[model samples]
Target: MNKVKLKIGEFSQMMQVTVKTLRHYEQMGILKPCEVDQWTGYRYYKLEQMQRLGAIRRLKDIGFSLDEIRELFEEGSHEPNEAQLEEKIKACEEELKVLLKRRENLHQMIDSQRKFKSMEKFSIQSLPEIMVASHREVIKNYQAIGDMCCNVIGPEMQRLGCKCSATGYCFTIEHNKEYKPEDVDIEYCEQVEEMLKDSEIIQFKKMPAVKTALCLKHIGPYDRFYQSYTEMFKYIEEQGYKIVGDLRCVYVDGIWNQDDPEKWLSIIQVPVEK
Candidate 1:
């Protein structure tokens, strides 16, 4: 009877794997050769061992860990169990998704920091309470507010021959917890030279008297608007002031059609007291 066996060098070449990799796999117990000569200390592999080596290489290509590949080989077949493979695939997918979201959040934070660095020096100014014509709507869906602003509010402001003197968008917090993006109650308002009367488009809403904040000026895209708010809050705390009322974002420019970040003028306001 003839025994078909190849030396380690020949087996490595035939299996398209480096000799060092084969030795490492042997140490890992995933790939054991047919026999090893005790006197010569030489490794020999049978031709049938080629199949398992190929399976190990394929699993490695698919990002499988050494331990996972060991488990696969311990099952004693070239094909792994379908359920186990599926579970690994799902785990890898979930990890990828989390990494992608973290990357996006980092990008947003960097953009905000850059914007704050370029802004003019902000100051604290006390603004008197003024009556503002307003309307309230229960927002079940957040998308509806954006639609109302663009489609309804934008057009209605133009129709009433009213230009925004000081416009703001605020959300009333139900509890002390941060408002979820989707569950926020958005209040959009614009200040005019004089309150309109007997007009269908303009409605009278009372704005309570309270000591509030006045920030310098911000001109940019709304995506990074939160930066201004964050800086303002930090300044407020540093000056030993406490927030007394709801926050507001006042618009100095009525034109929202401009795409340039430099042209959009907005002022972020916070109600505060000593």
Candidate 2:
């Protein structure tokens, strides 16, 4: 064979790379033309150079940057070290794990949005006073609400053989002056018709009747309960009422009664002053 030589344009077409990319690779010292015309200053490449261009594209498709591709090409035989390749694979795996978690959170948010469309109508109601067996804690996070309820308080009540009252109004009181996921002050109260022995964490107490509260029925995961809060406050602002006390959330159905998040029911109430 005459050892074919092609102009830069012809070689670019043959290798499926743009002229600009060829010039960039030349500047990056990854790919270079075989000849430059002394008079017209045109660049030319040999047909054999297509193999190098193919290698560049292959490395790029596998997420290698131009610097990495040049280092790969400089590795004597155009084959990367096994250790370096393994490190790259490990980094990619970590990135994939992060992306998977983000995708899961996105789905949860989308599901929450779908559930909010059927929000229940709210009312400003005069809530009656209630007596209860209760446990209060300043927790680290919102999940601690479930942790303290399921692990500590519920088990303790069962151990003591205390039964829920016939009325069965179980609710939580948030005592934080402002909403903060961390360092949350929570009071878990369950109506118990009879008296029971008390621990420092658990006691009997009364939640005073509210003259007026913006209350809404929420049916979904506790994580999505903020939608209820949003709607409740919107109504409160519309009616010209100032928030007077901590938010009150009554749990009608929860993990203790049901396994499905969609089946959980909460009544969110905000005390307001007219």
Candidate 3:
């Protein structure tokens, strides 16, 4: 009986693998043809190589890299070491966590879109003059603003026995003369009943009333604020209105009160003159 040998193409077909994959395996030194015709540079594989190919495919399907497979083959063991298998499991678990977070974010975005489809997007309203307790800081990023308000500013307000206004007006102002990617200069203000003596952390000031402001409701995560800004600017230009003062983002619902970012509502008020 003669031993069966097959060309690279025939072996690839029989093993249900690609010729490219076979070539890669050869380069990786994990699997090589049993013989090569020197003159034509043609490759030939013996029948027994089929078993090795099967093992390689199974390992790869279970998240094993070609390098790992090569190492396993070099150790003269087709089965992975216990430590190697545990490491792969840990990596897979981490990947699963990332995928789960992404899925949750997607669901929040979908719910937000559905709720905002029919809701009013823009409005013009008169803003009343109000006394407010304000705090300013250069924060790491926009996300850190929540923590700064809850932990630092909120405590200072309570210590001073600040009286919050019935209107429940609270907003943030970006004081930076120009845009910044990080270390944002932000001022947080909450409407109060009366002015109080300035503290190291908080200041009392009366905000001027806006005669007419273009308000745009932003629905969803703070990271998506740019979307609302883009629309607001376009609308302002179309209406031939000039923005008079720095924009104020009035927070209605946020991470402090809502678990879902999609449900968070903010009204961007840009003081404008026609």
Candidate 4:
């Protein structure tokens, strides 16, 4: 039986792979010519090399990088390690999640343009530094936040003989670095006339001022906040602003005063810098 061999160009044409790519694969040490002419320095490939090239192309199509492919076959086997393949699958799953979130944000942006074209708008404003009564707690959900304010925090301030500021400025800051549907870590702050002694439930401190804030009006239930958030983030990216401080949600009207959720209004303040 005679062994069949083809020149580099003939092999490249039959495999439908560019000569450059074949040379790159050789440089990467994942694939190499079966024979090299000593005198002429010409490369030759056997028909069996086609199987390896086909496998390499298939793996690349499925998100495997050249380095990963090389590492997989460095042990002199075409079979990939099960653990490494599992890790790749996990990475791809996380990427899919991010892509899905981006798609959802795009749809929300479109919906906001149609539904809140005139009703909601973003404003650049300054937030003044002021004395505030602060209370930090882990709440059950966002909706239950109002209960903590009306029952726990407000009453504590009154008991401590605290005088509310004339402006009645107040806002809630989320301490969470990531979004949570429940078990929310929240810090509530309300402007006051002067600093007072710290109590178990409340502490008086001076909230820092923000020179520039990207403020957006949210008119509806709190659950629909994603719509406003999508618009705000898009605006921030368009304006080339970097978020400098924590976000504050200033409650203008809610179950505390308004009977209807539709009439409730809140302001989202995001501190930013150019």
Candidate 5:
């Protein structure tokens, strides 16, 4: 009986792996051929290397990166040291946490898309003035909107024992001309029965009503608000309306009011000039 050494092509075919992947593994220093012909620079692998290749495939399937794989194999044996195994296991756990968050976000987006396939066109309307408790913050992400509302506005309301207006009118006044999720200068206001004592975090202020504006109702997640805006802006320009003031995003249902993104409803109000 004689041991067989297979060329790269033969090894790839027998291992049921792509040649490209094999080359990548070789470059990553995790795998190498048993012999290379000097004249032609061809790689050859012995039958014994099959077990190592199988181990590499399994490790990849378990979410180990090439760098991690390199570290694992740098021990000169497939038998992983405790520190190596611990590091890989820790990495896998961190990746799983990120994946779970991404999965949840996808579910919210998918659910919202299914809820509203089409958004309503912008309609011109007059907005009435209202007194509100307002706060402005420069935050890193849009999700901070909810955090500020919960931590600042909600607490202020509770501290004052204030009564909310029957209108349920709560909105964020976007100061930026365009949507900038990070470093957003938004003034969030919620209508109240009466103004409470001014606080550094949140203050009672009045929103000067709009005489005319382009308004569109968004009936899904905030992430899908872009869709409504895309359609609304088209309608606005076609109608000959020039935007005059910062946009107002009125929240009818949001994270505070609804658990499912499908139930969220927002109204985008673009103050416009005739």
Candidate 6:
């Protein structure tokens, strides 16, 4: 008998896939032969299998999981409908969003580790209750607030005779939501012995005493402080402590050079409960 159909081996060779792989796809219901010889139990592929084989290859190239591809094909006709194409597009978009978020987090971690290696470790100690002269505003721009801290806030502390305490600086967000960088309330403060008698920009506020925290001493560049925060949180978790209060970042030294992140000294403290 002159054969009109290709056997499994012939199809696999033409498609550049192994016979085992083709059999597995069959088991997965992604690809099934048009007919099987009853006596020999040999699978036969018609010309149509070539189209299915090409589709499977293309879908796999786009990061589709085998299970997902199988589902797609199970519901799909020989020619996919608009709805099916839309489903594939949506799935790929969702996967891209997840991958992008993971990439951002990893990049932040790498930058943080580099900064951590340059820091000197210090012991955690209790901070005394202190009075702070502060300025409160609904900060719409965090970058501007950061600038205000380095320029307006730091000098104000120096003038008030309230040198940077070892406890670090505190920024309390009164109201936060899906806020732009400029729309958050940022309060910048420093401990002072006495309130300024005549000051327009500075006002007095009491900082509530925190009992415990997993504190890490980080000196040099605020850019690396995120790494310090990440480390402190991990340490707190490893020690079986839970964060009980808002995190505090105390600026110890403020150099005027915005270009140099290596010269800034800051302490990051995460309040915790043992």
Q: Rate the local accuracy (lDDT) of all candidates.
A: 0.67, 0.81, 0.92, 0.88, 0.82, 0.70
Q: Each model's number of backbone clashes?
A: 0, 0, 0, 0, 0, 6
Return the lDDT, model 1, position 81.
73
Candidate 2: which pairs clash?
none
Instruction: Give the TM-scores of the predictions, in the order they appear.
Output: 0.48, 0.69, 0.88, 0.57, 0.62, 0.46
Write candidate 5's Cα lDDT for 1-274 as tens digits. 8679999999999999889988988887888888889999999998668988988878777667778778768867665667867887898899899999899888887766675566545567898888888888787777777778878779877887768888788888777777786898888888888887987777888788889978888887677778888988888788788888878899988888787766788889888986
Candidate 5 segments whose C-alpha is farther than 4 A from its true place:
1-3, 17-44, 62-76, 79-94, 118-162, 172-213, 219-230, 242-247, 254-264, 270-274
lDDT by residue for model 6 over 199-246, one digit each (tens)? 666777667777775668775555455676677777777888887766
The best candidate in terms of TM-score? 3
lDDT of 1 by residue, 21-45 (tens): 9999899998899899999999999
Q: What is the lDDT of residue 13 in candidate 2?
A: 88
Lowest summed lDDT window (length 10), candidate 3: 110-119
Query: Comparing candidate 1 with candidate 5, which one achieves the higher lDDT?
Result: 5
The true-versus-predicted C-alpha distance at residue 13 of model 6, in Å, is 38
Shift of residue 20 alpha carbon in model 6, Å = 39
Lowest summed lDDT across 10 adjacent residues in model 6 is found at 254-263
Model 4 scores a C-alpha lDDT of 0.88
Candidate number with the higher TM-score (3 or 6): 3
Stretches of candidate 4 exceeding 4 Å from the true structure = 1-120
Model 3 per-residue lDDT tens digits across residues 5-80:
9999999898888999899899999999999999999999987689898899889988998998998999999988
Order the candidates by lDDT, highest first — what do you get?
3, 4, 5, 2, 6, 1
Q: What TM-score would you give candidate 3 relative to the actual structure?
A: 0.88
